[model samples]
Target chain A: MDATQLIHPLLALALAPLMAGIVNKTKSAFAGRNGPPVLQPYRDLWRLLHKGAVYSRTTSWILRAGPIVSLAAVVTALAMLPFGGTAAPLSFAGDLIVFAYLFGLVRFLMVAAALDTGSSFEGMGASREVTFSALAEPALLLALAALARMAGSPSLSGLLAGAVANPAVSIPVLLLAAAAVGIVLLAENARIPVDDPNTHLELTMIHEVMILDTSGPDLAFAGYAALLKQWAFAALLVGVLVPWRTGVLWADVALALAAMAAVAVGIGVVESTMARLRLVRVPQLLLAAVACAALAVVLVLR
Target chain B: MDFWVNCLVVLIAMTNLRLLGSSRVVSCVHTVAFQGVLLGVLAIVGASGGLAAHGIVLAAVNIVLKGLVFPWLLMRALRETHLRREVEPAIGFGASMLLGVLLIGICLWIGSRLPLPVGVQASPLLVPAALFTLMVGLFMIVARRKALTQVVGYLSIENGITAFGLGFALKEALLVELGILLDAFMAVFVMGIIIFHISREFDHIDAGELSALKD
Candidate 1:
């Protein structure tokens, strides 16, 4: 077993929550408040794991299984991602489809879990999540398709690794793809300008309201899964924006780690600068992203 | 030089689509002006010689007219009208964007198939970008509801013609190129005057409603 192969997964598992911590700390700095420590996410996860879970009699087994299954899907998806110079643990031809669909599965379970709670608010969140994600999915797939065409590779590993090697593709295409993926990253992770993760107001919330029924280890799993999902998407974003390979494993890994941290801070900057978009206007923003990615696609295809 | 030309071409195409997808009239105006400036810069970059005298002159005039002067003139015309967006369009934003994409694809195909003129300095992507811009401009003119937006569309069409002139046509005749610029200046001035009349005659500037009037 190569040491490099283990680097991506281990780093993701250990540092996922740290991303959340960094994001909060950045936001707090922007807001002029001394926020929680950078390790707060880890502490929260630990506390949640230690507490006992309490479920209402009204819920079914789906509620219990939702977080675990979603976490499982995220882990599998993470394994398929190549970070910096470290190759993915499991990458095959057309693994991009599996990577994309595993998130779909996670979404399916999360929505199902939300619906199972019988809370109208969770249902609302579920619907909003589905609607926005439905708009966002084409942009994601189309952007990936653009990358696939440029690289002429169907899998995530080959696509990210070899896409830029093609002299035919230019910086504009990559910049546009990066922009599309950045928007999708923000949208999928329930960040600002799409959905606000920190809002407690039930009417405006999307991701948080859905998880209102979760507690204890289940909540911890969901939170951890979220962090991993963030890490995975951040990895994908880094892969698109920065594909620098030094041929030295440690150097490349360090660069990837730095890129991941930069993505967190970037997210924080975005959240601080822009207000959450109106629900009705969110599709327009996503459509603009689609236009951007589609332009890149056209450029690549041409 | 090639990368800069390619980026400019791509950016011009993007600005055309931005005009299509945008809702607000002012932003659309800004977008077309931005496209105009890009077209000017594209002309300068697409020129073979390094900052030739005519190239500098053409770029300066093009940028001044399209970027600064046209925007100021349009904003002056737009100030009297309370309208800020294209609220009721024949085509919605999403449909317009998709159509713009389809237009680019078709134009790219057509552009690749068409032969580039012999010994002319033009990027392979330039002709298609010009075609795409032209098509989007025409679409905007027809589909948009407001008069100000239609004017933006018209300027976009002229920008397309200007791009084509810089790339595929008028390699020698700076006179003809200047004539084209002067023609657009007059056309915009005339159109602005007409828009003023139309807005004064009617309470709202929705051009589609004008079809109801009979001479």
Candidate 2:
């Protein structure tokens, strides 16, 4: 692997938590409260890292392993992802499908861990996550497949690089993908409109309640991993939007960073402006993503 | 590898028969677990031909995750549930088995009709095995009332798909193979959790009891 490939996973690890922090700060500002510092999550991670975890009495090793496995899986996925049009360390045909499935692996672990706690509320959240993701996956694949068809390349790097040549198609497809991904971000990250990350009420919570019993570094890992996932999604969005040119690395890098920030801000705005959807309504939101992505595929094929 | 694949086909057929002929949850789980091990062996055999480091690693993952870990987890669940037999089946055993046979016949008929692509000699048995596995999985899901049994059925269907994938696409992309394996593992894991929860809340693992949320 080249230097760029080696750096991608480290870069993902470093930048992910910041995206979460930025969203939290943005939401705080919108709510007229003095928001936690943008580095609050970092501090939280540090504190959690130094402390001892309190395991739930009802939980098994699966609960303890959830965050570790989740972080490892996402990091592995990041290793497989390209940055700024560079090939990942493990590029192969249909690697994008692996990328999708790796995320599924993490989701599966998260849900299982939640269930291990034996909380009905957590179970409810787990159910929602699974059901919505099953619907969301086809959209994710259909969009990627559209890009794959357009580029005649199934690798994520090739699809991103080749598809950008046609701005008319790429932009709309990216927009649609971004919309779908945005919903996924909210749903997966337990953000507002699909879940209330900050809610104190256990019954209504999704992601937070699932982790209610976890403490110390395990919580830190889970929280940090969630941030990394958002960053990865944002990076993927950036890859779709910014075209890579030889000797234009600076421009590409700047655009990618800016796009990440924009995504963070956009997520914040959504969280600030919207209320959590009713449980039933969340599926409709995800379905809208599926619909948009499917349309994008049809359009690209046409 | 060919031998392993044939063994998988046989296991798939047995699992289908169990799903069709028995109303017992424990029996179904045991059959599916047996199939999972067959899939692991098939993975190893499939990978053995290439002799690449990637293939070796993938084969190891297949054995550990699919063969050993998953079955062990299912057995743990089975022990906890203490419910050995499926009390009632959605479809009668004889009828489902008859349908399964018809589906296999259809698969063979379809496989024989498709023309081979250039440079490729398609296997006559592969398509039929896959289709039969698919049909059996769907039948298991529809014919069984218990949530756990449905999951076992789903895994069997995935096994069939995995077998077909190995036959056709395994040589095409290692990534795809790994992806499918990972997805199937995660899917079963998720399904297991859901089943556990359903049993906890409803006092039983029946799929019909999960209808409380419907509009």
Q: Which candidate should be chosen as best, given DockQ against the real structure?
A: 1
How much DockQ does model 2 earn?
0.01
Residue-by-residue lDDT tens digits, candidate 2, B1-215: 44444444544554555556654666676667666666556555655345666656665776677667777777676666665454467876645655664665566677667665565422345566667777788878888888777877787787778766655534555788788888988887887777778777777788888777666
Best lDDT among the predictions, by candidate number: 1
> Candidate 2, which segments miss by more than 4 Å at Cα?
A244-246, B1-215
TM-score of chain B of 2: 0.83
Residue-wise C-alpha lDDT for candidate 1, range A1-302, written one tens digit per residue: 67788889999999999999999999999999999999999999999999999998999999999999999999999999988888899989989889988999999999999999999999999999999989888888888888888878899988888345644356778878888899889999999999998899999999999899999999999989989998998999899898768888888889989999999999999999999988987887888788888888988877
* DockQ list for all candidates: 0.50, 0.01
Give stretches of model 1 more than 4 Å off.
A166-168, B85-87, B169-173
At residue A242, give the lDDT of candidate 1: 89
lDDT for each residue of candidate 2 in A1-302, tens digit (9 for 90 to 100): 47766666776777787888899889989989989989888898999999999986778999999999999988877876667655678778898999999999999999999999998888987887788788778767777787778778988878777356655445555655656666666676777888888898877877777777778999999988888887877777666655455546555555667778888898899989988887766765666555556545644654
